[model samples]
Target chain A: MTTTEPGTAEEPGRAGPSRTQRLVMGGAVLLTVLLVGVIIGMLVRLPGQPPAPPAYDSVDVGFAQDMSIHHTQAVQMAAWERDHTTDPVLRLLATDIEDTQHGQVGRMLGWLELWGAPTMPLSGRYMTWMADAPGHDHREPGSSEPGVTQMPGMATAEELRRLRESTGPEMDVLWLQLMLRHHEGGAPMLAYAADHAQTPQVRNLAAQMLAAQTAESEYLRELLAQRGGTPLPL
Target chain B: MASGKTSKAARRNTPAPLKKNSFPWGTVTAVVVLVAMIAVIGTYVAVRSNEQQARAEALAPFTPTAQNPDPSRAIPGIVIKEYPGGSHVGPDEQVAYTESPPFGGTHDQVWAACNGVVYDTPVRSENLVHSLEHGAVWIAYHPDRVSGEALETLKSKVTVPYTVMSPYPDLDRPISLQSWGHQLKLDDANDPRIDQFIAALRLNPNTHPEPNASCQETTLFDQHNPPPYQPAPTPGTPGARAEDESVDPSRPMQTG
Candidate 1:
């Protein structure tokens, strides 16, 4: 039961729309504003926020865990050379290897901790994650068997024992041979992660590792050849 | 416009439907949701900002790599010395050196391990200088003075090979990082130049006299059991430990 005149109010002096109409229009405008605000908030946030975290078994986590283990062996082998060799060039190389790989290990552990993932892989089935990655060949490497070779580039228990016992040129040559093979073995895994890992950090780290190892591998070959030796069989 | 004479009369007779006032639940709901989103996102952004800042402060601002090997930083009073193979003194005893903890000079032919060793006790100067000859950067930190973040930085940097850190109870400065013929003294462990000094010298064969010298296991002297650091006893002084405090039992007579 309200006034229906287009330009007149029930009260004669008031020439504009009545209070009820104003309230209804204001509420409608406010509702529209709220709707628009919410739509914008969601749309704006879509790209502003961080991307979803990697899965527990994602390439990022797997690469970090496996590479950390690989780096450990490299550090250990380099330490052996540092503690046993007399050749100036070999010592220089050993120091470089030990320092570089050790730093890389620390960086990997930090990333794993940030992701809340376990530093070590579940059980001993390491490097299996790389199997399904693009261009991978070892879908079921079968490293779990008692003596089927648990890890590529890793020294055998017998070999490690002998390395500890050996010294002089015999030890120097053995260390170079073992480390060269180890770096070559790790190349495939590094390349896989560089191409497949989702996180930029993971991909970049893998690329860096690949570049460093490739260069080091070349130098190690030259050093070995200079000393009248060659890289050990894979 | 419709003249509403009929509607005016109707309003007069029935009375306008009682004017109603309702809560603005829709606007309130939108406001609450928007505020919650801001609070959560704001907190996340704040936390992330803090974490990144902390990480930046912990490490040196720039990392020197092989491509950028020299950071072009200089040591304040780096000592340089040139000594030949036969110049280092006898292996059986401590020798006199002009530098406090000799960076390089004639010392024992045998060198203490520089394979990233952190000596719990102060090592003899003569042996340590040999490590310098082999291109090892020696980092000396005082146990009582350096601790916390600065100490952590020192420890992390020394973890790399061709570096060694030891406790110097009587160091004039809190920390002294030395390579063959080069030394830098500083009071703060977080000093950016610490890593700069290391990057320029550690295994950069150009600076080392015996860049190829062995740092492996030794037969000359046990690293664990080495003579302590002390001002070498004068040649004329009574060789007895009772007469000379600097003349420890392990070190023989110091020739001037």
Candidate 2:
């Protein structure tokens, strides 16, 4: 038991607060300082909020995987032209296609690594991610199988064969036709990613691909027209 | 300040009653968690830095190979013929040549100055022999390979004789061979024929496509053409193979 004065009881302790009161006040100050320090540290450490965690199953991933496949075929076709065509302009274009697409493929693989995702998704149905997209028919209009039709402008086996067999001006014209269609197919995917991807890096890359492909597509159209051909109706 | 005083007093007392309020368990717990989180982040960064350093170290050995220089550098002087027919370049005279094709003068002519006299020849295998006979070291942008039979013929025809100082060897880059044909900076330029060969070797099938008689002219870069007509002239310096010794003339041309 300790001595207590009547006025001191009201005051809590002699000129100072009691041990309990002091402990409570000190604890409160310490708690505030720690909380503030933590918040400041974290805020300082935060890196632009890290472009919100990418959606695991997203339009962005689908676009990257599918477009990579598309670009691979384009590269293969371009390589064929480069090796076989005698036309200087066509050979130059083929080389450009091969070098640029190979670089883009590298970028996509890098993104997949950073996202901790597989290069391709475990989807039985390709392009199902775009079901909600209006005016985005991927098949011959009124086809029943939904996403079964080759996604817009893809060449069939026979078309690739014809490309390989023909040479000279005929080959150049056919290659330009097929490539222009392939770009048309690819443009929508890029546009979707540009509008919807969570990462600014992803969106910016998509926009760049869009601009480049669109310009190339226009050039192809002009090349075809110069050779007395027109773009095939989708 | 209060907490410091209370804790001190509690330590001094034999048995202190439990304080109504002491250290804030919530604040202490939060500070501990934050510190742990920061530690984890620091460790992650350090590990990543080490991995990058290790990767750079492992890729050091596979760099590309360099081009080999001409190794033959010895020859003896014998005789030389002057232009319009033949004359001798004295032992003290020099050779000056270029890759430029001959139009009016010997643009592609092989010329030598020896004993204060000048000798000139078309850049033919026969001329190469004449230059060597003058004790001149022959260098060409593109040295043509003479066939084994042709080399023998050249060896027999050479009048006042010398030796091959720097004979053509295999090269790694085809472009280097073709490009070198354009360079005429070395003393071998002292020969007049080398300038003619340089001009002839510049023809490209794509640029002109139709092969001209002049276009068939040879240079060292044209490895596919043929072997040296005779064994390469033996090096004349000490510690070198004897002049009677011979090099294989049928070695396969290295395809770049």
Q: Supply the global lDDT for candidate 2.
A: 0.46
List candidate 1 segments past 4 Å from native: A1-28, A46-48, A134-137, A141-149, B1-256
Candidate 2 stretches with Cα past 4 Å from truth are A1-15, A18-28, A36-47, A137-149, B1-256
Q: Over the stretch B123-171, how does candidate 2's per-residue lDDT look in tens digits?
A: 3333342333322223322235443453333332221111122233332
Comparing chain B with the reference, what is the TM-score for each candidate? 0.60, 0.22
| Deviation from native of the Cα of residue A43 in model 1, angstroms | 4.2
**Best by the DockQ measure:** 1
RMSD after CA superposition, every candidate: 14.6, 21.9
lDDT for B70 in candidate 2 is: 16
Tens digits of per-residue lDDT, candidate 1, A1-234, equal 233442244445253546775686587667667656765675575666887556557788778877876776687678778877889889999999989887887787567555545444533456666765445545444443321125578777467657767898888888889999999988988998898899898899889989999999999899888778888887
Candidate with the greatest TM-score versus the true structure: 1
TM-score of 2: 0.43
